[model samples]
Target: MTLLLAGVTLVSAFGSSFQYGYNVSVINSPAVFMQEFYNETYFDRNGIPMESSFQKLLWSLTVSMFPLGGFFGSLMVGPLVNKCGRKGTLLINNIFSIVPAILMGTSKVAKTFEVIILSRIIVGICAGLSSNVVPMYLGEMSPKNLRGAVGVVPQLFITIGILIAQILGLSNILGNLEGWPVLLGLTGIPAVVELLLLPFFPESPRYLLIQKGNEEQARQALKRLRGWDDVDDEIKEMCREDQSEKLDGRLSVFNLCTFQALRWQLISIIVMMMGQQLSGVNAIFYYTDEIFKSAGVNENNVQYVTVGIGAVNVFMTCVAVFIIESLGRRLLLLAGFGICCVSCAVLTMALNLQATVSWMQYLSIACVIAYIIGHAIGASPIPFVMITEMFLQSSRPAAFMVGGSVHWLSNFTVGLVFLYMVEGLGAYCFLVFCAICLVTFIYIFIIVPETKGKTFMEINQSMAKRNKVEIQMDKEKLNDFQTAAETPKKKEEAHSTSVL
Candidate 1:
């Protein structure tokens, strides 16, 4: 039963990873194709070539639109996951993926830019749902010991998908204007697979116990997860935790206008996610061609080299999965941030000294690759993992929504502003990102807690300890209740003994 549950998790995690890859990779090689399609279909219709500024604007809009759609999808995911359960939520999201892929593919073949944008938006929404639910599901379902590693699986798979897309995009057979549709459409395959398989997987026992208040179902689910019938103690402990907290539906952001704990959690997650975006990973992913072009690479070969970037991302993510469990989350985050900061600084310096030596181009590429490696190891998995783990069952969905919203918003901002920054800020943009990384390192060092090998409830208790006043108050309240309840029983036992 344990093996069966593990297998289901692996399948779900891989599906989520595939979604990440499909959503990200579809745009990679299609930039040129998209630009050409837009120019021929729209610009030429007006009998004028689009200006460079407009071209850049159009490109940024197309890219940013997906993240914007993601923002809405993320907001929806929290409630849906709360009500529908993880498996149902993920399966439904696949429908979003399938429909968009079909629309985007059809639009590309038909040369309809409007349809393409709409399709991408739909796909983005689907990706957003997967993004929010996948981490939450994985974190909730995994063993306490294996949680970090299992959580990192989605990140690893995302990189794999990115690499696969990059390679496929570079294929002479598929790397053309016509091939863009096929690339966009391929995402549907994994979505379909996930939708079909998810129904067979068990819902999260913790979610069921806490959210739905179904102890019997939760125990049955736990039995499956632990592969044993002797789960009564475990189930009782879970129930104790669940019952300790009042089912105040007022836990949501909408109900509680001022929740200090929830506020801090949201801020921390937002800062972490924003830091990840401001680190400029997306700039590298989306504009590898332009970056290479600026560095004196042959424009024709930029597509192939971009594939190398994707490969590096995937490789580093795999390394992270191994080390995340061993070295721990905080350490990995610090290491990744440190590497990215140094790499970004070096890239800035290289660009600034471009007039002095030809080697600067190589140095710039190395720096970008280093940044990717750093991101794959650190920022990629940590934010998602931390956000999901930080909150209790009741507050988790809302926390995820806030985090996912910030992440997508930041991604949209970066995607929209990157081209302009490159053109206007020139080499200084790398310096900006370097500064962000340095700040992120400090923030994680001071604020983030190590959740390695800890259960979700344990982590919550640790976090509550940070605020001594609140902790003391809550403890006193709990102690008072226990004392009051036991006093009656003590009196009754003494009276019975006296009568004997």
Candidate 2:
């Protein structure tokens, strides 16, 4: 069972989640060069240099299109994953990557920037689908005890992908003018590998057993994946969910929103997803090049620093994979956000000091590095794993839909307005992110329940108990205050004094 789970996670991470990070960081190193091409192409086609703002707008479109495409791709996940199953959606998603790769590879030859933008959108869709599907598939396949660790594998690979893209985008490698297209085009390679290998893995046993009601096939798959024949306990748990889910046919986000039984589970998913993305993780990634420049790093060596930061991210996420189960999801989520909150404050201070102090550039660099480390360990991976843990088979896909949409949309929001925010808010741009992180930490500390070594039923019951306790405490406090107020004026004053 361990070997099988490890093997499946390894392949899925490389094929799917890897592409998400690749798409994200790939455009960074080649930015100036791509803009040059956009200029050259504009001059060739229109016989004049492109206007500066228009050129920036075009570059922004190229860079921002990935997240926009991600938004659309997120919207597609519910229908695709529901209709085709997790594995099938992944297989079909490769088409988006391959076709876009061809278009991007041929962009220079064709001398058209439109093709490259289109490819970005298509590749974005591919990444969006992969990002959502991989986690859910891993979650469904994981055994209860190893679920947290297994769920984090995709995020770990994503950091690896970012590191790889950074290395590939180096000037000596693929970051130069001639090498840019090939860099963009190679995004398809992982997809092709995934397409070939996906068939060798079994369908998600939970999907087959609960969604399809195929006891025999589910049993076989469970046996193959778990390396044991005794499956009564697993099946009984599925039966509990299946009986209710089947009658509902298929649950939608709309259904999840209104379902009283799942209120907190759904709230946890929403708040976690929102906190993860809105905490400014994506903004940090988008802003890295500028952060490096502001820190007075040379332009030539900036990519190296970027790559180094990515390496830290990968290293921290690897640590996260090993420790997530032990610390439990709630603690890590809180710790991750807490560290990031402080890092952001430090970042804001460093940015503010860069003008007054010669060494503050280094402080800014240190702050950004610290922020990335904080995020890689907790904010990046935990919510992704937790979202999968929050819901059952019936509502999992819908939950992912809501979660993925919030994630990509928040990413899109950051990518879209990041430059303007930096221009307008300057160093204080990060203060906003700092505030978001602080509020998110307090909210999670108060509302999100711990889910370590717990079953779904147990988690649900515990949440209910916690909420009830809070409510009763609130009522008791209110009654005590009222009694003090209702006492005779002089006697009430004496009573209040005594209570104080």
lDDT for 291 (candidate 1): 61
| True-structure lDDT of candidate 2 | 0.81
Q: What does candidate 1 score on TM?
A: 0.88
Best by lDDT: 2
For model 1, residues 1-500, the per-residue Cα lDDT tens digits are: 26866677667766666776667767766788888888887764688887878877777667777888889888897679887998778887887888877887787557677777787788888878888898898787777777888788888777777778877777585668778778777888888788777787789887786777565577677778778776655554454455445534426656422665455556678788989888888776655676688788898788778877777887888888878888998899898899999998998888788668888877878888888889989988888999777777777787888788888998888877787898999878888889999999998888788989876667767776563313222444444433433453463444433211
Looking at model 2, the pairs that clash are: none
TM-score of each: 0.88, 0.90
Off by over 4 Å in 2: 244-249, 286-296, 464-500
Alpha-carbon local distance difference test for all models: 0.76, 0.81
lDDT of 2 by residue, 41-67 (tens): 999989999999999888888988898
Q: Which ten residues in a row have the lowest lDDT in candidate 2?
A: 469-478
TM-score of the candidate numbered 2? Answer: 0.90
Clashing residue pairs found in predicted model 1: none
**RMSD of each candidate relative to the true structure:** 5.8, 13.4
